[model samples]
Target: MRVLYTSIFYLLLPFILLRLLWRSIAAPAYAKRWAERFGFFSALTTHKKVVWLHTVSVGEFLAALPLIRRLQADESVQLVITTTTPTGSERVRATLGDSVVHVYAPYDLPDALARFFKRVKPSLYLVMETELWPNTLAACAKRNIPAVLVNGRLSEKSARGYTRFGALTKPMLQHLSCAAIQNSVDAARFVALGLSGDKVIVTGNIKFDLSLSDDLRAQAATLKSQLSNDGKHLVLIAASTHQGEDEIILDAFAQVRASSFAWARGAVLVLVPRHPERFERVGQLCASRGYSVVRRSEHSWNGASDILLCNTMGELMLMFGASDIAFVGGSLVPNGGHNFIEPAAWGLPLISGEHLFNFAEVARLLTDAGALIKVNSAQTLAEAFVRLLENDSLRVEVGNAALRVALENRGALDKTLLVIADYLRKS
Candidate 1:
């Protein structure tokens, strides 16, 4: 199965290169690092006693940060973090500083994986989330590098696809030395998909351990004071929004502005898109919605502007600190939703769409605790925003509840670190 997978991957190599070329024409940044997939193999050969961690993109890197930090700190480990996206590599560099080596993961071709393993000679390979590449797993197993799936999750959508190719996927998963899952449901999914039950351990979600440095918090406070100098009564933060979600948030903001409540008169909406490619599009969307938009990428925020478009990267946590109420994106349009815990950690009352399978447990806990509002449509979302803005008492109640939920779920980092430590010792 592994050989067949590798052969198919190589057969499509030319088309993949053409796709990269097309993307480069569409977005120059995507094209600039076209050879990054091959660059990993080059870097791997130079590093000794390498411990490679594979993540698909920025979110997974952030989710696996605590584990990365622990591995980097270990004297026996030479940490190598590989991400499939440019944004993920950038984030790993920013977050890990000088602690780990960052590289773009090689494509799952046998030769590429072989070269990467030969160069890095990784003692242990850790994969984040559900990025299970058959060739990569087979190559790691062949090299005798114990591959572990850390903070792993198996979404229903992903499970269906894997089950369709169970002959290939089951053997790949069974090769893993351990599967540190996010929750019991994830463990069951992995077990049903062919992983031994003993190999899958529920470690909870490590995203709850998201750290906000004092410097970052201070910067956010400074930006908040500068942006809301005249004492704006409310700041509605639309965070990690996807395509259509921004439109709904903008409409909700306009409704809040037109409300009869005195506090609604000076409300501001901070719109943040989920990806960098959509920054300009989101800014245009905000402007089209009749908002006087201020772009963060321009390092300019006008206090008089009704909306602030955060066109920057890796600063959502800071924005969360500056927000009064946050609408977590991805949920609004069935994108499975982004992390809501960052805002919750800052005691910001949260709102989201009904679709939150990505962070279902967090959403459930927040909803049960009255820390978050789950709305089904734009009208319901608008009403929730207005209610939170008008009723300061309700905002306070929900905000405190959110803080409590965040605090209660703070130990996942410790548990993940212990698992990585055990792996290192055994290796």
Candidate 2:
């Protein structure tokens, strides 16, 4: 079954590169680093224990930052961080800045994995989230490397997909030394999909362990002052908006402005699309709806535009800090929701659509705390915004509750570090 899977992957290689070429038309960064993907990067010369950490994209990289920082304190281990996306690569560079070995992850083909293992020579692999590959895990097991799946989450949809390929899935999971899952429900789902029950433990979500710096707080304060126009305008930021969700958000914002309240009349809408390729399209979408727009790239923000389009990266938390209310996107569509943890950390009242299987545990916590509101349509979204906007006291109450939930959920990072300590020593 594994051989068949590898053969199928080999046959699909050209189509994969073709799709990569197509995506590069929008995001040029995707075009570079082809050699690294083929496991052709220069070999690392390190006497220290090599620990490879894999984070597929920006979200996972950001979520794993605190853990990465903690691991860095161990001088005995040489960290080689791998990110599948260019944005994640850029983030690793921008934030870490030569502190670790950053590289593009190798393709999951057997030959590529073999070449990668020969070059990188990792003794322990910390695979973040759902980046399990049969070839990669097999190579790790063959090399006697302890591969630990950190901050693991197995959604029901993904579990079903894995179950369909149980022949390959069970062996791949059996290779893992351990999996520190987010919640018991997700842990049970992983066990059901053939991960050994004893090897999986519920350490809670590490995303709850977000570290908000004083510098970030200061930046948020300055942004809030600049965006609120000296406390006159009600600032509402819709963060991480997906392709389909933007239209609903724009229509909902229009409806929100229709309210008789003075704050609603002068409310400012900040649109931050999920992907950089869609930044121009989102700005254009706002203008097509007759809303004046200002891109963050323009660097001329005077609070005049109806929609403040965040065309920049790595400033999402700052955006959340500057906002009075936050409506997290991705849930509005079928794409399982994004990280609503940042907004909740910033103590901003949260709103999202119904789909939240990816973040079911975090969603439950915030919803129970009265910090999150789930809206199904534009009308309901607008009503949610109005309800929060009209009652200042209610907003403060919910925002405080959100912050409390964030604070209460701390220590996952510590538990995860403990879980992986034995694995790291296996080197």
Candidate 3:
């Protein structure tokens, strides 16, 4: 089954490259790192042992940073980080700087994985989240390197997809030294998928262990003042929105503004579409709806604008901090919702659509704590916004509940680090 999987992957390589080329039409960075994707790189001579960690994209890369920093503190560890996307590579460079070596993950062809393994010669290999590659894991196993999957999660939808490839997935999972999953549900799924019970541990979600810099908060304060003209406007942020979501959000925003809520006249919605490719489209959508829109890249916000388009990356957290209410996106359209941790950390009254399988546990915890509200349609979303804005005490109550939820969920990073440290010592 593994051999057949690799053969099919090899045959699809050309199509994959063509798809990358197609994506490059919007994001030119996608076409720029062809060599790194092939595992062709200048050799580095280092006496210290190498530790390789791989992530698929920006979200996983950001989630792994806390763990990466913890490992980097060890004198014997030379960290090498690999990401599958150009955006992830750029983020690693921007955040981690020269502290660790960063590279694009090789295409999972056996030859490419072999070249990467030979060049890096990693002492330990770790993969973040759901990025298990058969050839890469097999290469690590062949080299006798301890490979661990940290911060693991298996959504029901993804589990069903993997179940279809049980023959290949079972053996691929068995190659891992450890599978530190997010919760018992994920652990059960992995065990049912044929990973031995002892190899899987429930380590909790490290995303809960988020760190917000004082500088970022200060920036948010400045932005809030500029956007609201010294707290005169009510700020609502709809973040990480998908295609179908933007239309609903805009409609909801219009409904809220026209409603009898007292703050309706002062309301301003910050629309942040998830993908960069849709930033312009979302801005146009807002304009077509007759709302005065301002882009975040302009670094200028006038209280006059009805909508703020957060077209820039790495500023989502700051924008969340500046808002009075947060509506997490990706749920309205069937794309599983994004991380709610950011808005929760800000202690903002949060709202999302019904679908939230991706961050099920976190969403449940928040909803139970009265920090999150789920809406099914544009009317409900508008109602949620108006209700939260109309009552100051209710907003404060929900916000405080959210803050408590975030506070109570602390220490996952410590647990995760301990597990990885123990594995390193035994290895």
Q: Pick by lDDT: which candidate is best?
A: 2
TM-score of every prediction relative to native = 0.95, 0.98, 0.98
lDDT of 1 by residue, 223-266 (tens): 77766664655788888888888878777777777888877768
Q: What is the full ranking by TM-score, best candidate first?
A: 2, 3, 1
In terms of TM-score, the best-performing candidate is: 2
lDDT of 1 at 259: 83
Worst 10 residues of 2 by lDDT: 418-427
Q: Compared to the true structure, candidate 2 yields what TM-score?
A: 0.98
* Position 366, candidate 1: lDDT: 93
Candidate 2 residue lDDT tens string, 239-353: 9889899999999999988899988878999899999999999888999999989888886778677888999989898899889999998999988899988998988999999
- lDDT of prediction 3: 0.89
- Candidate 1 clash figure, as a count: 3
TM-score of 3: 0.98
Which candidate, 2 or 3, would have the higher lDDT against the true structure?
2
C-alpha lDDT of residue 313 in model 2: 89
- Supply candidate 1's per-residue lDDT for 361: 74
